[model samples]
Target: MQRLLRRARIPPVRTAPARTAPARTATVRTATVRTRSAAAGTAPLGLLYERHGEPAAVVQLKNLEVPKLGDCDVHVKMLAAPINPADINMIQGTYPLLSPLPAVGGNEGVGEVQEVGRRVAALKPGDWVIPADSGLGTWRTRGVFPEEMLLKVPSDIPVLCAATLSVNPCTAFRVLADFESLAPGDSVIQNAANSGVGQAVIQIARASGIKTINVVRDRPDLPKLVERLMGLGADHVVTEEMLRKPEMKYIFKSTPRPRLALNCVGGKSTTDMLRHLQPKGTMVTYGGMAKQPVMVPVVSHIPQSAFIFRDVRLRGFWMTQWRREHAQDREGVVAMMDALCQLIRGGQLTAPACTEVPLQDYRTALEASMKPFVSSKQILLL
Candidate 1:
């Protein structure tokens, strides 16, 4: 990274002798001044939303002030940020984490360190980094952030991988490993099987030798979606209807009853997956794409044995909350990222299907992100 940065660095211009300016010298100095102003004089452009509403209606592209660098600050040139469901929810005033009005509207992205303040030690110019937590206002061209707020990542990983890493993939990995004591050959089930976190769950589970029963809403392109999940190492893929049918038993024949059920789509989808968990199993809810409450019966709605005797556990996770709990544990975050990076390097992990859209074309990206059955993640290139 340092070598590449050295090669790309523009040589400093030599000053002409201090004297009365000739036409050519005057032109040179004026041009130099303009170049410097362009590089550092202006504020950066960002996607800002002044009032909470539909993301498309409220979010606007505007110039944002370049904050003064503090002794512990790191100046960064953002490379890319993804349009996530949480980002949309934050814009719509639905999510728990909302910045003040006129807030820049992104929570996840990767950036290149341009310069470091005097007291900043760990991060240097040319390093790749991501926000250590959410609500950092990442949908901008540049920023001056404190060193502790940024996590330095390996420069070799793909920008899209680094940009989209902190949220979904981390969520997936944590839920899979944290909630249950899953081992090789143990089965896990999840709804919204094609989402960013779901896809990460599939890959990470596959890498760990745990089987996954992926559930998705039925669509005309079911075969194609199933094929895509299969290619990502899913053990099985089924529709919401299929999950409710008697034949769900047939799936457990190959893999054991799942000990962990991951619920992203709440309502019936959550309850249905819960029915299949092994005795003393766990169900972790992290999202509600269905805009419905998780309905669980007190009595025998699920298989009476599973409900009465199964001892099923239910829990919830919020990445922002997790970040807050780990606020001072930056080393722990770095260690987790290091493990994820190792998987990335070994091809055990990969980014979701992403559609790169330039920052100026954010409307197109935001629109596509809300459309039904859209699988590819929308990434805004800065």
Candidate 2:
């Protein structure tokens, strides 16, 4: 009887509620497996904008959270970016548009991609890139943004040079390329030859076999300045003061007559350039550093072109517009940069001296950078 009880004690195995839908309904399948989210890191390094106003309004270095990534995003570690005049103006809230509050302040930097989203196919970690726009907040040690806005930079190019490339070099390219009819034998004249854009234009024109007559403010190192420019392929180097010479026609006759002139400095500087331009020539103005309106003489009028009275037929060239039209020419841009790099490597291209500083030394660096005679372009290295 005890053995019979033991057998009966073993309960029958219970079956799952015969899941009328095969033990488990499609609606009641195992819970979906979740993939891990992207890892977050410490805050990035950068200059923050606590307020809006003047240069002293509030530019400070502070740690901030790494920006969150989007589906087509790229996270970059900024190597270096320059402090251009535009940057200063932007920070002072004097520029055409002000940056958002509590934003980072810097444009034109070179960086390495540290992370990329699944949808970002073109770039990968460790690849060097730059922003298409100079004002895209490049002062940070790291940032996250859509891949479409990034430009892959050549590894051979020096980081400092890469940092300054977006604005100046691109502007130089536009000035040279726009007047396609202007040829190698023709001469182009410009003021502010000491300016970054002016220097770039001289080099580019030299490379293209075009002649350039550069006009710069007289400096203590005038001789050296002239020598440097000549070495960069300047056909003739003159001072703006020379433009007012009563014997200007006699003096200009000995020099190449400029068929195309680039004027960035308005006021008296504009008149100076106009006086040297060959009749029917075109002058393109990209800036007005003189802080005065360009004044043209009434006698400059000629029947061939009414533009003369309008001051050498002035026209403005904006780099942003040029970039839009040539967006498809990324390869071309890369090629130009590569060619410049090759020249740099071959010793044919004289890279302007660079003043290196740490990323955190922006205030001092900025002060030195804005100084008129400060040697070399101030570069903030990460």
Candidate 3:
């Protein structure tokens, strides 16, 4: 039942201006709005950064103006945005590659189209949408981006899930498609089963009639964790200790060995997944939350027809790739949104637990989001 709080009485938050082009190459698609006149008394308030640095080092909530929009651009009023690990990494300059200095944070969010420039079609004011990551700065109260970068979402969809849809759901879909040759009734195993991506994989696979063997690090709240994932349609749940136990052999006595193993936790968890793979099976690793390189026994890769060992293959996925592969991936995204909405409406897909944070409380929100035991996601309401 969580919802993103959209407009406030405050003025819009602006962005760093786009670079100018040569006169010969420039096309005057629209009149440039006067920076001072257009903004007049309207001051922008946002989580601003003056440098590429750690979240704690440079990020601050301050007043600023809305960025200029081009003829084909649209201005979006942010509804709610999620504080993802990647957002923290981007702000920290710890990501594999960092954004330009002084850039705003956040990549996943839901927004309402507030205004559109001339020649803009397909979208109109009041439409709920998600901007493509190429647009990047969603933490602010508002943003301006080319219309092509916006993906429309139905108004009835839950804002919490809409804010999270772009990355986690896409990662889950891609991993399910890229990894092992999965078939109905076949089994897949994954660690970090309570994670956003893991939860999506469970639901998607279940919808396809595929079974799952979910693994998680042991915790005092294991029972609640199991209940949550099971509610999302998980087949079985086990702790790392249970998975590594010698007596656990008979548990797979009648059930088929997993053909696909999805690993998000590396190190020992990665090794654990490889041990559960059937002959000629595949283990696809997409994340390393354990912060350690995967350690695999050499024997797991030795080719043997019966227990044919193919080293677990590793692949990296980013939603940007999905967008690149299909320029209209947004349409597919909307379709998936429709599917998730149906599940939610029918009372099948329960809403993920979400905590709403005001734009000014980002620091506390960021700290809480980084905690090891927060349920589901933390959302920033504009």
Candidate 4:
């Protein structure tokens, strides 16, 4: 099992040769100006939204004064931030947790510590860090945050990986670790297998010697996507249509019956996945991408039958609630980050495919993020 996990590792990083003077000059000039501004106490540029509505309609680029550092504050220079679906939902006033109006427009990203207040002890000027909680407004070039609201991460991880480490990867880890007491060779099934969280589950489960049966929506490029996920250690990749077929039962002949089922799309997609779960198995629902309530007929209601006869259990997980429950245990949060970082450093994990856009091109990035069936993540590079 350990050897299988190591065999699935990503290739080693490669360094690029130095660029020519013309290319290098622009980068050097920009760094010099940014450094001078930090020294002179100039305000940084931020994407601000005064009202909740469409992103392109409400979000604006503004030069806002940096807040005065508190006794335990740390000032950070933002590096990269990903445009997640949750960010879009929050901007549209639909997410479960909404920030007050006139707030900054991002929730996740990584930044470099540019300055630290006298009372700050765990962080220094060069340490890389991410927000310990949401609503730090990460879409800006710089920010000043309370020391307790940030978590330090190692500097060697790739910028994209660090910027995106918190939400999707952490969600995947918590669901897999907390719900089922999975052992080596235990099989798990999930839908929306092309999503960021789904991809993370595949790799993480593989590293733990657990098998995954991934189901994705069929698309024109279905073969390509299936190949891509298979390369990432997915034991089996099937379309939603395939999952509903009678022959799906043959899958268990090769591997053990799935003891854990993960549901992101709630409707028939979830129902189909549930049919394959072993007796007394558990299913954790984290999302409802289908935007439809999970319903089962009275005569064949699997939830009722499974509960009464098989002892099947159903539960829901929300990362925000978990964080709130564990708020006082700062050490526990740090330990989770450490474990995820070690996977990245060991080449056992990598960020989802990403497309980098400059902060000024945010409108384009936002549009790209909302497109149907878009696979690559759009990241805003500060």
Residues 1-382, model 2: lDDT tens digits: 1121122231111111111213321111111111223343345667777566655447777775664677898888899888777778777766544455666777677899999999998899989888775457777777777787788877676777777877877677666665535555667888988777888878877766678888888878899888877877787888888767676566456566787788888998886777677776777777777779976665533532325343345566766545555567676556555555555556545545578888767888878776775536777887
Q: Output the lDDT of residue 31, model 3.
A: 13
lDDT of 3 by residue, 1-382 (tens): 0010011111111111223323342111111111222342365455666666667768877654676777998888889998888778767766644555556677788899999999898889999988665336778777777887778877776778778877777666656665454667788889988888888788877766778899988888889999988888988889999998876577677557888788888998887777877766666666788899977676434532223246444444555544555564455555445655555555555445678998878988988888886666888998
Off by over 4 Å in 3: 1-42, 300-312, 328-351
lDDT of 4 by residue, 1-382 (tens): 2332234331111112222323221100001111123322356887778788999999887776677787898989999999998889878887777676677777789999999999999999999998787777889898788898888999999999999998988888777777677778999999988888999889888878899999999899999999999998999999999998888878888879899899998998877776788888988888999998764333456444665666777777767666656678686677677778878888777898799999999999999999988889999998
Poorest 10 consecutive residues by lDDT, candidate 2: 25-34
Residue 289 error, candidate 4, Å: 0.8
Q: What is the lDDT of residue 72 in candidate 2?
A: 90
TM-scores for candidates 1 onward, in order: 0.88, 0.81, 0.82, 0.87
1-382 in candidate 1: lDDT tens per residue? 1121122231111112223323331100000000012343266778888788999899887776676788988989999999999889888987765666667888899999999999999999999999887778889888888787789999999899999999998888668766766678898999999999999999988877889999999888889999999999999999999999999889888889999899998998877887888778988888899989987655764464445667887778777666766677676666668768877888878999999999999999999999999999999999
Candidate No. with top lDDT: 1
lDDT of each: 0.81, 0.68, 0.69, 0.80
* Model 3 global lDDT (CA atoms, 0 to 1): 0.69
- What is model 4's C-alpha RMSD? 11.0
Off by over 4 Å in 2: 1-42, 246-255, 300-311, 325-350
Q: Name the runs in model 1 displaced over 4 angstroms.
A: 1-42, 305-307
- Minimal lDDT window, size 10, model 4: 25-34
